[model samples]
Target: MGVGDVKRRIAEILREVTDEVWARVAWVAVDLTKELIRTGRRKIAVLADDVFQAIGLHKAVAYVKGLLGLIEYPPRSVDVVVAVVATSEGLTRREIGRHRWASHRPIWNMPRDGFIQLYGQIPGGKPPFEEVWRATGGNSKLLGELYKAGWSAEKALREIADERKITAFVKTLRDEERELLRRAVDDPDVLFTREDIPLMERLADLNLIVDALPERDPWFWAGEPPPERDPELGIGRHIAWQTPLHREAVRRALGG
Candidate 1:
């Protein structure tokens, strides 16, 4: 359906619901519609789907807006880049550009605001720290939550891994996928082959796992000139739990 039609239908649906229900849910759809409209994209249908899905997930509209406001609003390119770096540490600029929502422009020129740190300096006449990028401090916390939430406000709200939601989400996983999550919990460094790509991607979408490099110690960058190593050496990705709490919750759900 056309974007206008989608909006009209959403309005009609909202009107049909009681005032109490409308106060709780309809405003979310309305605000999301306004946000989508500002992007000038014909994605109202998708927004409509997300709105109801969010309601079904029992997400508060404030929770949804808070997460989206942090990572998906105006200047989304910068936030997207930040989230990419947040989720996967030790990424080179080239690697950051490879993510779904990332672009070369943002990678090259985005403001770091002290949230992002680039390591590995080049000798001369080159872009600073072409080697690896990492998100720092509270920015990392917020971005990691937003990223692990799969950029979905509904998912973000549920990321705390409440028992009921975790169980509900776990029930939707395929056998192999559950096995994979189990393996990851047992060995955060678990390796996967080409055949596992689709499963890994799906699990990633559910915010159950992330692919990341080993974290570098703060002392590694403490010296006068700081230690320099070949960024290529440790760039291999490893499967990891999105958070310790998420791991524990999944473990309980999997009965491990």
Candidate 2:
């Protein structure tokens, strides 16, 4: 398919999914606004994944704002699109040097329990949980890529590493992100105190690390942080590799 066809298909998928969401959850959204408005609520959070990559931030936000303006209601809820990587006006962008939305919200990183739910749906059968976890680290993007191979999950992971994606990622790294990703292979937990927040914010915005807190306490992975460290630094949560697979890829990229 040409780029135009690909974009058209994506639009079609989004339109279909939006329709489905409205059909099923529109009432919930309406009720939520109504009740929340009664209580003086003003923010309606909408997550737009890859919005920056697919369409520039400005246009995407304008489109969403237009949608919000059309809502016939009294609560006056404003839609706020949180970013995976946004520009200064709080919109996700594909470019590397954008000021990330608000590093407050955690992006997509499903824990192990989520894998069980996903496993049951696969056709051939879920591979061993440990192997799957090791290979993908609950990263939906990598898992989706691996799932397409139709082989056992382990085999798929072993066979098709994204050399191109890794190459692109390598080229984008600056001095700091490169150093951070390099260290991540040896010690996955990035302790982000107030001092590291700026760097952490940038890294998180880039989808390099994610907030790993209360969810995976006492984590038992290859480079798990010490349990007591987070409390001592007061860094809320230890930032972790987006995926073990990515970390492994980085290790190879960094000549580890």
Candidate 3:
């Protein structure tokens, strides 16, 4: 059946339920509808049946409520969004959306107003501004922690590195992975290719390294500037330590 018909049917089934139960069911239905739209799925009937069969109506309602209760409230969401903006200052709204943790909500949807500020414009887009998301002075400590090193380049490095965390991370790496990290530490200016993506991605997942564009001019933020390209690094993204402290921590962990 069509999505509308499926919703009508579900509503009919839920009609006898109290307003509280109906509200809970409606909340889940909205989330499910969004997921279906996002995935371009058409089998609404199948989803409806599965939802009913997998968990009875009563239990499903309770489950969703439980999950909602577990979710930390608003400012936590604001913190995550701000942290991302702080670390990656030059990202466009579209680029920020690529981060899995960043919700579909607007960047300004924060507990405290004026948490983020735009710096300059980027050419050729609806939101023409590069939407350089920078945390205001209030979030300076967080900003410092995420983007500690370098003036011009958008280094995804953390300002402070916890040695114990680094040690634990090292223990989890395979010998080859450890060796690769050692190479990164030994050659901070190391260049990587497509062949290195898998390893680089692993390190990125561990928050040790990040793949980013080459450094921009320190003044680039002051005005609209053409994108910078590093011929030596070619067109591919460059890999760098997540933080200078991370590099130092890794060096110590690797016995450098």
Candidate 4:
């Protein structure tokens, strides 16, 4: 859908969504998180992409904004926070720290056991959902489409060709793929070969590129930069502005 179409749909969803739908999404995400904990995973990192699909960002962000307010003065549970908050950015450590009125202290304690029981009890609204959906829901469809199209991360990354929006973190890579790529780059003696399919696959998953050698391809290792460049190499060299004596008029313009 075009930007206008998306905006209209989101406005509609916010105006008409029921509490049942809200509860269902929360339940699914919480259940998945609980399972991760059960499997001995200490930290359950959920990508907000799925929730953004279900609910638009304007509504989602509003929900989170409401939750944050409730969390401060009234002290809401983290599970409730997850239920209302759809995007990952809202749940940052800084955000959590800013919610000062919460009766319950924030918990980041480690060594959490396999059975970490956390309860969530908070009602929706007390804030409008439409506002939250608008901010976070825009890219939901595109991301979902790429995943459905059998596009690898590397493929998506290459096709998109913009790292600023996508490469927010390195954990986007799968464990095996990360290991393979790390090994390929770190060991100079090890030539990248067909055997490195898994590594290539991983990079593909993250939307990065790794062109074939092709007798000397410029893109052989395109996305990655050489690791050993000196930090101070560019020290004390050129002037910030490229003008000799500020070029007559330029100096007058700056009131120098």
Task: Give the better candidate number (1 or 4) by lDDT.
Answer: 1
Report the lDDT of model 4 for residue 251: 25
Give one digit per residue, the lDDT tens place, for model 1 in 1-256: 2467656766766775765555445454445544555565433232222332324333333433433453566422331312111122212322333444432221111224433432212132322222112221112353455455544434533455662367777788789878876776666445356767666665555555544332334332221211122222211235554444455566777888
Candidate 2 C-alpha error for residue 111, in Å:
3.3
Candidate 4 — which residues are off by over 4 angstroms? Answer: 1-65, 68-83, 90-93, 101-146, 159-256
Q: What TM-score would you give candidate 1 relative to the actual structure?
A: 0.34
Q: All candidates' lDDT scores?
A: 0.43, 0.48, 0.41, 0.32
TM-score of each prediction: 0.34, 0.50, 0.34, 0.22
Give candidates' CA RMSD values in order. 15.2, 10.5, 16.2, 22.7
Better of 2 and 4 by TM-score: 2
As a TM-score, model 4 comes out at 0.22
As for model 4, its CA RMSD to the true structure in angstroms is: 22.7
The residue-by-residue lDDT of candidate 4 on 70-127, one tens digit each, is 3343322233322233222222322333555322221111111211111011132221
Global CA lDDT of candidate 3, please?
0.41
Give the top-scoring candidate (lDDT).
2
**If both were scored by lDDT, which would come out higher, candidate 1 or candidate 3?**
1
